[model samples]
Target chain A: MSFSHVAIIGLGLLGGSIGLAVRAELPGTKTTGYDADPDVRARARERGLADTVLDDPAEAVRGADLVILCVPVGAMGEAARAIEPGLSADTVISDVGSSKRSITDALVAALPNHQIIPAHPVAGTENSGPDAGFATLFHQRWCIVTPPAGADAEKVASLVDFWESLGALVETMDAEHHDLVLAVTSHIPHLIAYTIVGTASDLEDVTRSEVIKYSAGGFRDFTRIAASDPTMWRDVFLNNKDAVLEMLDRFLTDLALMREAIRAGDGEMMHDTFSRTRAIRRSIVALGQDDPRPDFGRADHE
Target chain B: MSFSHVAIIGLGLLGGSIGLAVRAELPGTKTTGYDADPDVRARARERGLADTVLDDPAEAVRGADLVILCVPVGAMGEAARAIEPGLSADTVISDVGSSKRSITDALVAALPNHQIIPAHPVAGTENSGPDAGFATLFHQRWCIVTPPAGADAEKVASLVDFWESLGALVETMDAEHHDLVLAVTSHIPHLIAYTIVGTASDLEDVTRSEVIKYSAGGFRDFTRIAASDPTMWRDVFLNNKDAVLEMLDRFLTDLALMREAIRAGDGEMMHDTFSRTRAIRRSIVALGQDDPRPDFGRADHE
Candidate 1:
């Protein structure tokens, strides 16, 4: 059955985007959302991010058939708990956390009576808050549904249909595997971007203004992501600690080998590694995951 | 006096772009080009990358008032030497190498009687070769001119005007300072991207297909840059070893601090660092170096 009433906890980018997308794509479904911060709640009301922007999570989830907690990964459990009082016993609970395993466990533990099928919509921009929500944020994006082992087939199908209506392609994977995949694809990339931007700013010899001016050379792409919602990313790195750390370790090892190759003037090795990575980009473009236009079709650059 | 004839050595992305840009923006200017690779020369000829695509660098430079060497950074000396036979003593010699210090030194040593001014058009796509070039590549990009001390003012001003005509903002700096600034902006960003892409592909737990499918998460941005011309990037690292290494060292140190913060659950540290970098992005967008559209204005993402 299609969801008639959907509740969203934590009305930030993902939460608010879901509300807006549902309003645009599934007009029959009513969206109720709550943010812990009053400023965000008022802004969400002004933007009509949801049909109803409630001040409390409990009030937001009342009478809802589906409740999606869209808070930072670390706060998933608390958000779920906050909605527990008003949530119906049969409500299917889900989330849009970057890392799935911990969130799934935390959610399942907090809402033992409800259907907790954690999902991560692998879509976003660097911007956040009520203003960042848009109807097309999930268009052509992937949303991985990491349903727990005993999830009901009908509920899973219904959730899939919900995301499909919002223009996201749906994939199913085990939560553990989801964490591992996203660790490489999302978490580590955010970390590296954050690290490099910090690195550029911290350099004493290179003026910060120079880094900003020449960022079009390559650094700007990283800054777009490094500027992402800090709290959300911080929670991602912390909650997905093992997977993110493991990926970071592998990245550091590979980087050290590259450093040695450069130091030894091993042009062939650097060239081979760089060449192999190019194919991955071609594959990403082929899969329609990225814009094939040069420099992502930036106007001035063209 | 304005240059009526311009010669380009190495008909790759940068060289062919200069030829095409001059043809489009300065229609009266005559362009001659050569590539050491006969296949690239033939392709350039087919594309009409220049008014004439000559077989030899010497022939290409004959009667040219300005000759710009656009070979790999490591090949700057050899490219300059090859054109020595036909290069006029009055012709201004310059190059489009990412690393300017070694290139300037090499060009000066190879053509002691000619004016050698090194330049780097801080613009490019990841793509390479004649097929990868277009006339508009340098529009609104920075073309840093790194002329050595005691360089002729008239020659530098003429070169600046030439670039300005083709739609690039020009800035003059010492070659050494240019190398250091680029080390922070471009070189280090590229090395980190290459390393992370390699690391992601090498993961034992995450499948490559999964990584490719979910690259929209942020890894896709790195792949675009990691997919850059390996030979050119290899040359850049080798030629600008000191500055690149210094920047790399600084990046690693900052990254180490970030890793520690993550490990210690220092959310405030990550939050502040990530927040500070947002200003840099704002400044870049304000300066019009990048398209301010979400997701770099990608069609699929839009």
Candidate 2:
């Protein structure tokens, strides 16, 4: 069964984008959105983020067939609990959290009677909040729908159908595997970007202005991801601690070897490593996962 | 004094770009280009990358008032030596290498009598070679000109004026400071991107296909830089070894602290660090060093 009414519990980039996408792609579906902050609710209404903007989370989800919590990963449990009173017994609950395992556990615990199917749409710009949402955010993006063990097959299919209707390619995976994959793909990259940007800014020898001025060399690429939402990333690291730490340790080990290679002036080893990484980039472009244009076509847009 | 005929050795991205930029922005200036690789020279000729594409490096620089060596950093000395037979006594020699001090020393040692000045245009796409260049590649980008101590001021002014004529903002500094600043801005950033991309690919648990598929989460940003010309990056790390090592150490220290915060569940630390990095991205945008649009406007183009 398709969701006739979808309730988005957070009116941020992901939530607002879902509301906008549903409206644009599925004209029959109605969207209701609510944010804990009243200012966001007002802005969402002004932007027409949903069919209706409600103040109370329960009121927003009252008659919704699908309730997707779009809060920070650490706040998923609280958001689920807030919408519990209004959720129907058959409402297929889901979330757009980066860490699947923790979000799945928290959501199941908070709404025991609801069918919780957590999913993460592997797409976003560096910007966030209500103003950052766009209808095409999920177009041509991957949305991993992670269902709990023994989840209702019909509901899972319905959730997948809903995401597909909004132009996302859905993949079903267990939460444990999803967390591990995302740790390597998402969390560690973010951590490294954050670390390097901080390192560049904190240098005594290189002034911040110089770093900003000459960033086009390569540093600006890191700054784009580094500017992502602080609260959301903080929760991602905290919620997916084990997987993040594991991936980070692996990355650190590899980085240490690279350091040694550079220190030893092993040009051959560095050249081999650098050359091997290019194939993956080509594959990413061939698979249509990233922009094929050089500099991500930034110069063209300018 | 302005150069009536400018010669570019090494018909790759930077050299081809300089040739095109001079042709587009300085109509009166004549351009001659040469590359050691016959294939690149053929391609550069087909693209009309310069007014003339010569097979011999010495022939290419014969009547030019200015000759810029645009080879990889490791080959600057040899490229300088190759063009020595054609150099006029008053020819102002310059280079576009990422590492300034080394290139300056290499150029000076190879051509002791020539007025050698090194400049790095902090601009490029990940893709390289002759076809990867464009006429507007240097538009609004910073071109750092590092003249050695006791260098002729008129020759330096000519070089700076030439870059400015091609729509670049020119800044003059000593070679040592230029190396240090770029080690933080360019070399280290590339080293980190190359390292992380390599790390993600080698993980047995996370298949290379999986990393490529889910790279949109953040890993894709690094891949753009990681996919940069491997030989060029290898030389960058080798030539700027001291500054790269020092900066890498600082980044490692900061990353370790972040690792502890993640392990300890210190959300506050992560939040503050993430928030602080946003300002740098904003400043970069304000200064026009990067594309201000989100996702570098990739989604819109799609």
Candidate 3:
């Protein structure tokens, strides 16, 4: 059973995109949107981000069959609590948070009686806000649905069907495993990007201008990742702390080995490491998970 | 004086791009190319990578007024020595090596009497080989020229003019400084990417399939960088050891601080670090060094 009425809390990139995607892909589905910030609600109304833009979260969720909270992970509990007054007994509660386990726990605690199934669309741009979202953001992207233990199979199927209708491939996993997987894939990459950009910015010998000017040499890619929404990433790292820290330590250990190889001039080891990675990239391109064109088919190169 | 005939010693991505760029942007400039591997030389000939693709490196450089060695950094000396017998007394020696100091020293030692000036074009896709190059690869990209101490100014100016003719913005600097700047901008970024890709691949808990499937979360960008030519990257690390290690240490230090912040749940610190990075991305976009479109304007999203 697909959701006919979807309510999105927090009208940022993810929320706005879901609204737009629903409008484009499932024209019959009604989307109601709300944000804590009044300015965002005003902007959401102007952009036609939903069928109805409400100032109050509870008002927005009223009459919705599915309520998807799109706020940062740290705010999931508060957002879940905000909509409790408006939630119907049959409405399925879910969130678009990077880390699923913590969000699942928070949502369960906040709405003890509601059906909670958290999911993360493994897609986004470096931009944020209502203006940064578009209909095709989820097209051909992976959306991992992390259901709590013994989650109602019907509700889980409904949520998966809803996402599939919006052009996302859905994968169901336990909340614990989802957090561990996304911790390596998303959280740690962001941490590394944020760190490198920070290091580049705080350099004493290399001027910031030089870093910016010669960025095409590879530094620009990190800048793009590092330019992601600060609040969202901050919360992702904080809430996904255990898994992120674990993945980060593994990455650091690998990096230390690389550093030693560099210091010792172990060219063969470096070459082998560099060469084996191309197969994974090839596989990703083959699977349509990434742009097959070189440099991601960036317009500047063309 | 503009180069009437330009000799490219390695017909790989950089070399082939130079040939094609010269053909497109400087129609009058003739290009002669050679690769040590017979297969690459044959492919370069078939692709019209240069006006003339020669079997012998010496034959390739004969009569050319400028010779650009585009081989891996470690092979620069051998490539320089190969063309020494055919180089005109007036031919200016340059290279497209990532590390300027090492390349400059190698070229000077190989052709002691010839004018050696190393320049690095901060441009490329995550691709290699003769077929991977295109005419506009250097358009609007920065070409940093690091001339040896007491190098003839006219030859340097001529080299700058040649690069400018190919639509590159040229900057002159000393070799040592160029190595330091590129360490942060290019070498270390590649190292981090290679290490992260390796780490993700070697993970026992997170299957390689999972890593590839969920790469769009952030890991795909690093995979692209890590998929870069292994031989070239290996040479970059070995040749620019001091500066790359220095920058890597700084990055590690910054990453440690971020790790601690995450462990301590310092949202403010993470937010502050993440926020400041956007400005650099903005500057890069403003300067047209990177694609301003979200996700580098990847076609997969559109």
Candidate 4:
């Protein structure tokens, strides 16, 4: 029950990467792609992002057995609707949205008769658009599948196998829990990064050039996350509002406590929390989520 | 005016790197190193971190024309006091503390009769200790030197020349201004990173494994910064209390506004801030403060 013909409805970073990865790792499968922007479509064609790059979503999905919506979360419903005229009755529908709950609801509302499975391949660089993706984008990364209740087991299994074939490790979880996990892991971190970078840029006392010059000490890391596509992140915050707000509350509580500790000059409390946080980083590196070499091994780039 | 024999008290990342960088870049100068922990001293000796790795701080400083304290900010005074017995009267004293004001005061108070200049080379990785140092650690990085008002120009110029010889681009700034700039650039970013990583780890609903598994979305970057040496960061926040608190207040204010924007579903505000922040990352890359490659160019390791 493997997917032989796949239609990617957005030829951006994730979509284009999927096309490239399928070609690189799952060479037997065929990929068709379409983008709303003609410029992106032309660029995707130039880069051979898909086997057949089409001008319309309906045209792209005509003979495909699977369709993956790779647009922003806020556009999931419209994108799902666009392919409805050409989607086969048995075609498995899925999307790569950062927030699963809203996208799941949107997809179901748009295509109630289709088999919709929402998945988030937790991988990317700060760059975006067609040129930002590479064949190895999903390598060694996690792809969380949030299949709705009563989804066909065979279809879901095939989808899992499809992602695994592209070098991603797959895990299945409920949409609500997926939303909560990602809100903690992705949404709130991005929001906090954007906020801090904004704060640094707006300071009257410290010039922006100084911040840029001295960024290697720490601030540069935050800027990378903050430089993500503004539209995608804006939709993420809007779509996953509940879980994001909940996580933000927890972050604020912890930040206030730290502020108090610093204000009181409580070195012990600061050290305790800072020391406790080291274990998670070690676990992340040990589990292969990140590079173990110093400075993410960038020192050797030259 | 140049330092012929240099003594580095505290053979951790910065001290060890200074020794290695001096050996690589300034072959004529001799470096003597000491660490408080005997285990670190042993490792430094095996690594040949200095020309002579002494077991005692007092022994390390004998007949040295320049002695640099590279201990944590809180330990600067005691490290200075330890070398008092062996310090030559003409030797120039300096330190590599992140926060300049408090370290400058501590060094001056501990060695009132010596020429004291405080410096901060804005460079490091999350990993610390003697094993983390490399000869190119300070290559193309900024070294901020803060000299007191009455300090000799010859001594200050020589200190600048020394840092330049070690591959750092040197800049002179007042101690208080140095604290303010670093509070915005380095200290506050580390505090926010520690706070966010702690917030994610302590969530009762989200298991730690889940957070670690899906960290690639953005949280992993924060964890790296948060994983930095706790004792050094604790002292940094404590020593630069006023500037850090001021910067934290600004960050909190901006964060609250972002929270309000998210709560209100104001996509435009979120987009505007997120988009504006990209310029800083570009400038940092343009200035060579960070690697411009995607994901810090870490993908090649596997």
Candidate 2 ranges beyond 4 A from true positions: A300-302, B300-302
* Tens digits of per-residue lDDT for model 1, B154-178: 9999999999999999999998899
For each candidate in the order shown, give its overall lDDT on alpha carbons.
0.90, 0.91, 0.91, 0.92
lDDT of 2 at B235: 92
What is the per-residue lDDT of model 3 for residues B1-302, given as tens digits with 9 covering 90 to 100? 77899999999899999999898988888899999999999999999999999989999999999999999999999999899889999999999999988888888888999999889999998999989999889999999998888888998999999999889999988888999999999988899898888898989998998898899999999988888999999999999999999999999888899989999999999999999988999999999998878899898777
* Model 1 chain A weakest lDDT span, ten residues long: A293-302
Per-candidate RMSD, Å: 1.4, 1.0, 0.9, 1.1
Interface RMSD of 2: 1.3
Going through the candidates in order, their DockQ values are: 0.80, 0.80, 0.89, 0.78
lDDT winner: 4
User: Which candidate leads in DockQ?
Assistant: 3
Clashing residue pairs in all predictions, respectively, total 0, 0, 0, 0
Candidate 2 CAPRI assessment class: medium
Task: Order candidates by lDDT, high to low.
Answer: 4, 2, 3, 1
Which stretches of model 4 miss by more than 4 angstroms?
A300-302, B300-302
**Model 1: residues with Cα > 4 Å off, grouped in runs:** none
How far in Å is the alpha carbon of A122 misplaced in model 1? 0.5
